[model samples]
Target: MDVMQRMERLVEQLNQYNYHYYTLDQPLISDKEYDALYDQLTALETEAGMALPDSPTNRVGGELLKGFKPHRHLSSLWSLDKAQNEEHLLNWNNRALKLIADYNSKNPDSPLPAPTYVVELKFDGLTLNLTYSDGQLVQAATRGNGTVGEGILAQVKTIKSVPLSIPYRDGTIEVQGEGIMNLSVLAKYNETAVEPLKNARNAAAGALRNLNPRTTAERKLSAFFYNVGYSDGISFADHREMMEFLKDNRFKVNPYVTYFDSFDGVMQELHSISDNRSSLDYLIDGAVIKITDMRTREVLGYTDKFPRWAVAFKFEAEETTTVLESVSWNVGRTGKITPLAKVEAVELAGVTVQNCTLNNAGDIERKNLKFALGSRVFIRRSNDVIPEILGKVTDEQDGEEIIVPEHCPACGFPLEQRGAHLFCNNRLECKPQIVARITHFASRDAMDIETFSEKTAEQLYDEVNVHEPSDLYTLTYEDLIKLERFGEKKANNLLDAIEQSKGRDLASFLFALGIPNTGKSTTKVLAEHFRDLTAVMSATEEELTVLPDIGGIVAESIVSFFADPFMQASIQKMLSLGVEAKAPEKSSAPVTDSFFSGKTVVLTGTLHRLSRDEATERLEALGAKVTGSVSKKTDLVIAGEKAGSKLAKARELGIPVMENEEEWIKLLDGEQN
Candidate 1:
């Protein structure tokens, strides 16, 4: 098929997939298969130099806009009157019934029916108005002054459930919905976000209002349509019919819409929605009740600020302003200090909150909390998350400044500034650092040292001078048996665990070493790249940065660590005490079970074409055990540039060796061929 035809077909398929997955919650295709199709379409578009008008790729705005334009809405988006209590709700019902009675009395022969109510969730998000023209999405805006709003068409396009085009092509229509970030999506984003969003409401509103459309796309927003604000050629008989019309046109109408025949039923549904809102994926501040009959709404409508037909039954508020009485610093496993705010006890979202996180020192400055101590600050508590300090109530510097600590709060060591954080570098003398390092080393993903705990690390540090991880290898019955409440079996078990830890694979050993700015995935990549502990330790930053996942910061951390004399001595001592850190063997590497099989090989210096790791891998693939040193039992040695003492010793021991790069590679290559 031609490129344009192919692109059109792909866009239609992907949009249908998106509708099923996002709106209907029923995925028609697996993620991998969908991605493959998407990739093919993206390549074709790139090849053709243009994307189809309805392409899913339009979700990302090609460029940032300077500012939002004012959107003059076709129909004014009216606000709903709020009912804070059952009495206020009853008053609203009485007013609606009275209006209907007056209209019926005037028309005597044709009377309005008793009002049935349509109840829906009042979503706690920014109100969005979307306009569609001739089957295609044309504009999106925020509800600004009821009649005029700020255009956010690019931002709204990022919402996958908002169809770029609809089935209705005869005329234009405007649909109203709430733009929101799902609670689960917000939680997941916060898990890895550098600056976590304080709450879902602000996160959604701020993203949609942002000048950069990329920000909106990254937030993964969703929307639920409830009203057709303006329609040129279509009309509904009732609220249910309007909702059905919205759904038929592919709008994501909220499924919580319920019809209640009586005011008591509406009240019950309101109570039920408020009670069960905590279980919902999105946040809702209340439930809304609207007159179901279109004719009844027409007769009772037209208030200055709110429609007489609908009222929002608001639940309790979740945010409050509180006095920031004090601030305290707490240290974590990585020696990074975090600020915790002590606020005046305030009940919020069903809990009394006294403490909230200030995130970090930079965050304190960014939030203008440096001078907010003993001042009123805005705080919010979501249902399950810890309460957060949003900001100071005002920009006025009316209170004491929160001082940044120059020394570690726990160990009194000098603190060093790194990026937005302060770190304590006294790894040897700091109590928390030592304790945490030991505890992390014994973690399941690390060395798997059984019966080890932070309490045990603290006790060991206090009783014996176990300042470094290597010190664990030296513990004995004499050391452990003297500790308080230490039984014979306990000491033996501890020693056995320490002994067993020596055999942990290279990746786990690297992770147990606790290099800063590195994670398990990074250590695993390092193990795969270097394949030998000595090679990894000796890897230069230039070499390290070339490997996958090894960025400048992590490479620098690894280099700086191994270059330290104390750290070097500790690792050497561990090896001397019989720690055997080796790479995990790959079973799929081509195995040449020939001459190199059952042979002990020694690799010294570095080949110009291949790294020491490469040579070691080939030797191991050929069934050779690559050792670090030359000895009488060593059968062969492959030496490269600046071959030193190990190479000389191999010559002295009369061990067969290949010193030329060409001959060495040829011999290894011949066996594999």
Candidate 2:
């Protein structure tokens, strides 16, 4: 077959596979077989110097748009009128029936019948409007103000479930759907995600609006079409018929859609959805009941903001009344103090809720919450996780008002408010703060001290003289055996882990120092730039800020940390305890013809050809300063699979990108830009 024919065949096959796997929840081919086909198609398309717009390769990503253009929708996407209870649903139904009757009386020849409702799950996600012209996807937009929205065609094209080209090829059609992040996808994503998304709705919204389509692809967002915003080629007798048409056209329609002859049937279905909501893969905040017949819907038209033909039956919030026993301040690893409310145990969503997050002092004050001892409060458990206090339940101010702590709970140091949070100024001196720092220093990501635990750190702090990172090196087996649960094996293993940690590389050692704003990636950048701990400690804020990935705030924090006499003393003590902080030796490759010579490069995402360590070494060997972030000063960015914010920023700044391992290796071998 010719190249174009082969491409056409591949696109059709891939679309079928996607439909089966993502839409139908069944796979006809193994993942390995599918990948082989995909690779073959990609190579053919690249060699042919042409690619169809509907090719599956588009799912990988697209060139970043300069900015989202404003798109005026063909029809205004009206919001649903909400019904919180059976009474509300009945009232709406009664009003809708009366409207239909009035229309029937006015037009005697064409009488509108009593409205039958079409019930569907109300997916808790961002609303999207997809426009198709002649069966090919043309424009995709968000629901900004019902009438207009930002175009997000590139990002939407990355969703595997969203058909790039449909079977119907007649005229322009607009389909409305909810772009949802599956609960399972969110859970898997949060497993390795740096910042876990709060909920599926937020994740879906964030992915849809992301500047880079690559980021959106990584999110694995799905869409479920329910409404027809506008259509020219097709006509449907009812909402159910339109939904069936959407499903037949390869659009994902909600499977739970059912016809309800009466308000009682609609209420039953609404309750059923609410009861089993936790078992569903996607989030649904409510159930929507719409008039079944197209003619009846027209007769009972729309209000100012909502459709009169439909009403969203909102599920009652999962909340319960509980008594606030006491409020306590807990210092986190970063020394930021957060308020924890000890509430009287209450069952919410089949789980016993005790402590609830107060968020911050501002949240408590804004809620006008009396965090006084033994006050009645309402606690809600949303998404079946960490419960939160909604507000005070009683008007009586029967207990003492909760006050922000003046001193750290773990140590006696004075607390200072930084923006909305309160932080302990004493970094190394506080007991809990010191233990947390030491525990983090020995964490596997930092120093790879596998045997170290927070419990051990606390024990050592209270019983032994272990107060800082340096104190950990001073711990002896004799001192450990004196603790309550310490035995010979455990103590020996912990000591061995500590000894091994002392020999960690400069990057790990830098991270182990518990420097504020310096994560593992930042540590790697700092180590590559300065080459040693001494250089980093002596560097001024201006010098540090100029280095790759080091911003003004981080530089200031670094300088301030090193300039402190206590931090200096701690470092000196650690060095005296035989801790060897050494930078990795450079490669012997000559740097004269290197493309990376004197360039600052940031590496984001996962490289297939080399591990992150190996890639960093290669870049540094060629006189490049490898960094963790992309900034305007960055000369190049080597982006690989699943690259996120850094890649977006690099493209936004018009920084050059090395897309794959081959390009990166070529550049390392002195290939010209």
Candidate 3:
């Protein structure tokens, strides 16, 4: 088919699949087949020398914005200080332990028990700022210098990782999210770039700051929404549950993220992630451990830049002593040449350590590094994660210069030498890039086709000529039977899935498009709020920022997604194939005053008459704002059995305190009778 006809056909196919997988939560095609078609379109667009206004490739990366616009935060966005070293971390842990111990000791009559800590990955990326108006996405910015930040709503939209809308029943709310790059994608991008990145964190940071948003669109930056800044209607008793609620709202939260039951468990989890960091697809600089209960956090209170209830354990690089047998060069997706060190097999963290990587030639020259086929080197891992040779030279040894590759190892392409690095010019045809891109297209956050394994995708890319997501529709049972062990039933089932997936919603389709910065939750929010795929594809800056979770960055991504020809064609093709893309209904309520409407209510002690959920629900239903613990800002404190600090604080603050459930009920009922 000619370029236009090819484009027309591709758009019809992609649109249908987009509706099925995203809207219906069901898919028909294998990831491999979809990827092949997507790749073909991308290739065709590149060759046509024409740009479509709406294309998936356009949302990949973004431009570095000018200086921040100095937007004030509704609540001060605070930065957490790293627990300087192991000793400091231990001290902080002990302090928390002692605080609980002392509290129990002082209140012998009815002591409070210590609760467990929740630990999570401290992602290395830009802190995204989002504002919501009546539970809709409205504004987004970056944490520029903490207090003031630039508006990046347009730029942020390009990132598929961030949500375009929030899931809350409130008038206004602000949230904080983190933008990050995964190791797998980073590895792939670096393999294709002229200068391969040293790490995912650096790459993510760089991608967020690109001068041209169009350039930024190529990096595939991802992010996770974590915090609620301001709230009007919704209430969360526990911090962990709040996260769960965010997930329920279709926000793409971190799955590896977990909460703990105790201090020991939290510490163990921290250590475990550190040990297994190399295996993780994303880069983490430290562990963010917090009190799972919101009340506990409120009771603990805040320091200058951090909450006293939370702490971060930043791990140092992991170093191992090993004998280096030999060194060899390898080509990456971006064509950058890297050196690999063959190490003697040694057991480390359950797995036998066989090979460690050396970043570039500069690293070799820095340590006066040499590979005499047998040399000793200390291998250092990132965040105690990935194994890499830091340097070498045992006391009694002669030195030798490290041998570097003169050509690409994978394709025999001529290597271009640069400062401290070498690169290959084989861009699209590169094996690593092809495999990685195809795999990425078929990933769960993308088309979401079930039972499509990476191994199967690899076979399609290598054995079959499949290169994009839409290509799956072109395949037949005959195509599958040709492969080893391919049966009629399996092939038909795969085709059925691909066919059914044509009706996915817009966000999933956008996510499946693999737009940079766009991740799971962002897609969901966009899909829900925009109503139709075309609206998002054609959304302006003002329009995107009007949504809850969508920020400058995410807005930009949406704009870019629609700006690209390939992505647009994909949408059209899916639509032609009878794909239906529509958003879920939004809940709306009138602003009528209820009992708790204007009252600031604080609960203290334990209530026998009502559970926390019941109490909060009634208060919220009545329009009352229930805050955690008791403070000077408290309007009224409802005291139950054995009220402690909150009661004392209420009295000290001269705030009115309700003695029992009867008194609280009386106030709610507005009855002296």
Candidate 4:
């Protein structure tokens, strides 16, 4: 076949495989076969220098957008009215019955019967609207403000469960659904995530809003179509029929839906759902009870913000009352002191809860949680493994006050207070701090030293006299073999791992240094900008601050770290031991000036296309000074996914903002306003 014909055939076959595997829950082709075809198609598209709009390659993501464009929804996606208690639900039912009775009285000859309700699980996730034209998936948006939403077609296309094209052709059809990350998916993601998501709802929301479709694809999100927002040349007699049609057209419909003629039957299903919620794969905050008949729904209509035809019966928070036995202070890897509340053992969310995180000293003060011994307190557990103290339940104030430690609990070093956090300043001598530093150095994101554990660090610290990061390089296999459970083979393996880590990239080495206020991203910026260790060591605070995302605080911290005699000695020792800190090669592209010329730019959040280091290099090449924090001095801010405090602060300071990769590229090419 010719290239165009071959490409067309591959698209059809790949999409068919996707449908069978994702929508039908069956695979007609082996993964290897599918991948081979996909690779061929991608190669053909690249060679042609053009790609079909609906090509399966788009699922891997194409060009990063500057920002999401506003899409006015064809039909308003109204929220469901809520009810908390059984009494409130009954009251709502009574109102609905009364409305039906009034309708019957108005039309005496054609009397309306009591409305049968369709009950479905109210999935705790981000609401999405998918529009299909001529059986092809076209537009997908978030339910931003009911009338208007942000277009997220590319991200939505990544969801395999959502059909790229449906069987029905002609006219636009809008399907409203909940975009959710199953609990299993969330658990799997958390196993590798640096920061575990609080809950599945947040995880789903974050994934859907992510700038990169590849990220959304990696998240393995699912969608359940619950309602039809708009449909042309088709109609359903009831909600159940509509859901059936959606399922037939390759859209996922909620499996746990039932029809009820009375409120009592609906209540029974709600009770059953509540009892089995823990066993479910997805998070459901509540149960939605809606009038089943389409004609009945029209008669009920909607309020300003909510539909009168449906009511969400919200479930009570998962909380239990427990006694606060005592409080314990624990030191973390960063030497930050955290308060752990030793609560009386109680069962919460299918787990036995004894200790709860009090966060920090500020949290205790803000919550006014009098850590009075034997005081009754309410504890709540969300999707996180750790439980948190909600509030005190009793008025028993006759107990000892919890005190913040002035010294480190482990090393007895004086604790230094910075903002709301307290840290141990003894980085060199403190045993726990030293071990944490070593563990962090060997962590996956840093040096990626395999088989290095906290236990290993502790053993090395006590037995091998490994006080500093550089000391690890000096250890002989004989030194490790002396430790318990350390055979000759194990010792050699560990020594080999350590040797391998010595050749890690400069960014990794910089992060392994554990410089205060310098994270992985910041370390990348430093490595890319400074080029070499010596340059970084000799850099002034002013010079450091001029780099992207290196604010005054980080600049000062880097300067102080290099200036410290102990740190300087450690770096020199590592260098002498043949630790190679290779700098990133400079880009070959010539420098150009547009808006970024001599501008003070700050970047925040996760970028879709460029790493923080690459973005910094691009800005710097254009004579831009990339700073960390937002201030009046900041000329521009490049905001990306989850751009939080810095983005807000930039707006407060009236700084111009570029929200995505496309805008940054356009500005660099002198093509943007």
Candidate 5:
């Protein structure tokens, strides 16, 4: 088929698939089949130099925008008055009752119906208003001032759940929803994300407001439509009817919406929702209660700021204001110095908050915590993780300045600033840096030195003057048994483990070297690409950057790390001591430039060529992190027949997948070649 015709067909198919997977929570095809079609569609779009407006490829943004344009909403997106506690909610309900009673008394012949309510979760996310015309989503905006807002159509399109088109094509309509990032996605993102997100709310909001729509797509935002703000072709008699219309039109409606005949029932449901909010994947700050009757809402009308028919029952605050007492700097294993804020003991999110991560020197300055000592600061705890300081409660800088150390906290070596972080260059004299390096070298993913611990490294460091990784190899049983904690058996076991690690593959050995900005995936790629220690150590920054997963920073780090004469000497010494960091044989080497190289892949279903164990080994040998389950971190999935939830999940996540058994065999064949 021609590119245009083929592109059109692919777009229609992919859009339907997206609607099914994201909105309907079901998949009609395997991830592999869908990905094949998607890959073809993307290739055609690239060849044609254009993508259809509704293409799934557009779900991820292209380029950065210069600025946002203003969008005048079709109808005003009114805010809801807030009720903070039981007393406030009761007062609001009583006021609504009084208004209804007064209206009923005036219109005795044609009285309004008794008041009922529709309760929905108040999503703690950025408010989004989408305008559609003739079944096509035309514009999306923020609720800047109800009437006028920033247009973010491209950013909003990145939300897979937000339909690019709908069944309703008669005229224009406006739908109101909240854009949110799921907490689970956030956690998964933080696993490999260079800069981890602080909280879901900020992550969602910041992504939507970012100049680049690509940032929005990276956050994996979801949206739920709740209000038909403006509809030229349709109207609803109640909130329930409006929600039904939205769902029928393929818009995502939150399932938590419920109608109640009595305000007491609504109140009870609100409490229940708040109690179970922690179990939800998305953030909800409170419950929204609105009068269900459209006519009743018209009679009640709107206040200057909010709709008189609705009120937001706000939940208790998770954030707490605490006084910043001091800031402490500590060196991590990477030799990077991080700042830790010491706050006054305050209760927040059911935990006593004292210390919080300041991230780095740049973070402290950006958060305005550089001069925040003795000032009250806002702190938040998320997902049971460590509490983090948001910023000072006020912008006033009338406080003691947080000191930046010129020397390392662990050792007396001069500290140098690298971007936002400070690092110590003393790999030999610095006790903590060397100890941390050795500890990391013997860790599981690295050399797998069994029974090795930081305590053992510390003991060796202090007593035997063992400072570097090579120092450990030079030690004998006599050297280890002399330590306080080491018995004869313990010493012998440790020595054996160290000896066994000498035969670890080149990839593991490279990872154990503790190169900054280089992760396991990068190290594997390095091993696969160079295949020898000498070549990898001699690789240039430009050459290294061309390899998979190795960016400029990682390239520079690798070059700088290996260039050190001391590092070269240490490696030579380890080699002389019988550390055989051997490269795989020519035929057994991973395809250095394969698509799967350096990607975290998951294999599911039945394989025709090999068992799961053999496939995993081949994938690992091919430089892929073979995992058991599919997550955001998974880069690919090779599915066979009867591929179950894992394959479906891969489809839902837009992961690259292929179920072609013939192609699988070809790849396995290449492993032998």
Candidate 6:
């Protein structure tokens, strides 16, 4: 077949698989089979030498929103000043102690008791700032710029994990929460992953950022509302009771949260939480320990970032021992080789540490890691990050070194030695290299092939002669069904996906191509400026040097990628496949103007934005400063109709009010440039 016919067929085949996996959640083609087709296309395009803008390789992160609209947070969201270590935490406790002492000195008859500390898991996910008015959900946003954020209320509601409305009535409440994705879910997703997600945090972040709320919903994103941002009608004497009341109201509270009276107790629980963190399904980076007494908490108040009463206690990296079963090396897009240690499963922190990344040849050699056919190796999970091997124990070891491969495991190409690393020079000919390249191309931050799971990707590798993403359009349903675990229904679905993927946004397509160091955000900037992949490829390294965030390293990577024979061939294949690499339709909104500009606004109701991040980002961009509570310094209060105490306080403080989205947006429009 001619190149054009081969490319068109390749696009058709790959689209079917993409649709079945991403949209329908049913995969037809085995991953390895799909990869083989992608490989052929990549090779052809490289040979032909051109970039296809609409090829699955492009859809990653796009242009930054010109500027987000500002919404006033009903409660001013403050950042927690960090307590770096136990010493800092102890000092904070002492400060709290002194504050209580001074309070008792003023009121001798009714002295406040010793303060208790509440400790909860500090999730590493995005921060969700929420406002509730009269027991109804209002604004939800991210903690963008700490003061304003993108408004994503419509999208936030779609997450079944976040309650649409609070259970209580006749009261206003402000809540702080964490949006979390479990490690197990991430693992399950990665198990079938074409390219395993880097970590759960990245997965959750990507899922949260998706424009399609349905995608967020399918991710099973969950939230834990830990703090009352602002509230009326209901009051808690302490943080513990507040959490309890939040749970009583059906908010998904963190169950591991507890209260302690002494620093020793706090320390003990910190250790306990750290020891058991991996056992929990969700990912947690540290523990948040907060003062319980509201009265004392008020005196302690907050800094610009975090609450003075609260501090996150991060656990030290933990190390454990596991038996090294095998050593395998995987080829990377840069042609660098990474050694992986396969070990018998052993518990560490909360989850089982099974496999660890050895990084490179230098890493393997530096540790003197000679694994007996079955000897114990010391495994360490550093600060809840991906586990790695610190060293090997040769003392009375049970296993000997498992030989590292001299050639590519998938394509049988001779490996090349480059200072402390092994390289697969086979480029387009190697199956492992091709599959990895294609999978990286379709990743969320890359081309964003949502349905490309590891299992399917592997099947494509093992079954189909297909090697890269561009080759996907060339496969037939029969080819897909021949792979293990794929039937006719599944095969048809995979075929359908390949068809749909042809029309994705341009930035996403660039990201899918798996160029080294060139991620989603970078892709967006380049796509917007160049307007097409052809321009990008034709541009000189010097021309790319001036772009924002694109420095010497990134510019070098981009230039090197375009210079590669394989990349050139893949681009041609994409063109032949009829992939359109053009910039997406731009939003008409002015880049500078925003609603909150030059306004001192107080938020006093539930918001439609995702959380405080949304509201903060909006307000900041438009030149508005959002404060926590109503005070003499306040200017205007944007009360979302059903605002609670802050609303009343605003009135008492004689602040001007814009009662709804119409008036608020109108007032904002009047202030804009």
lDDT for each of the candidates?
Answer: 0.86, 0.82, 0.67, 0.82, 0.85, 0.69
Q: What TM-score goes with each of the models?
A: 0.58, 0.52, 0.45, 0.51, 0.59, 0.46
Report the C-alpha lDDT of model 2 over 511-629, residue by residue, as the tens digit. 98888888888888788788888999999999988877789999999999899898899999988998888886763665656788889999877688888888887788788888876
Worst 10 residues of 4 by lDDT: 586-595
Stretches off by above 4 angstroms in model 6 are 1-317, 322-325, 370-377, 382-385, 392-404, 448-451, 458-464, 476-489, 587-673
lDDT over C-alpha atoms for residue 313 of model 2: 82
Q: Candidate 6 residues 501-528, lDDT tens each?
A: 7777778787877767887778878888
Ranking by lDDT: 1, 5, 2, 4, 6, 3
Greater lDDT among 1 and 3 belongs to 1
Candidate 3 ranges with C-alpha deviation above 4 Å: 1-67, 84-87, 97-113, 318-673
Off by over 4 Å in 4: 47-49, 319-673
Ranking by TM-score: 5, 1, 2, 4, 6, 3
lDDT of 5 by residue, 396-514 (tens): 89789999999998888899998878998876777777788999999998999999999888888999988889988999989988789789999999999999999999999999999
- Candidate 4's TM-score: 0.51
TM-score for predicted model 2 compared with the true structure: 0.52
Alpha-carbon lDDT of model 3 = 0.67
Candidate 4: Cα lDDT at 83: 93
TM-score, structure 6 vs. true: 0.46
The C-alpha local distance difference test score for the whole of candidate 4 amounts to 0.82
Ten-residue segment with the worst summed lDDT in candidate 1? 644-653
Which pairs of residues have clashing backbones in candidate 4?
A: 548-626
| Clash pairs detected, candidate 5 | none
Q: Which ten residues in a row have the lowest lDDT in candidate 5?
A: 584-593
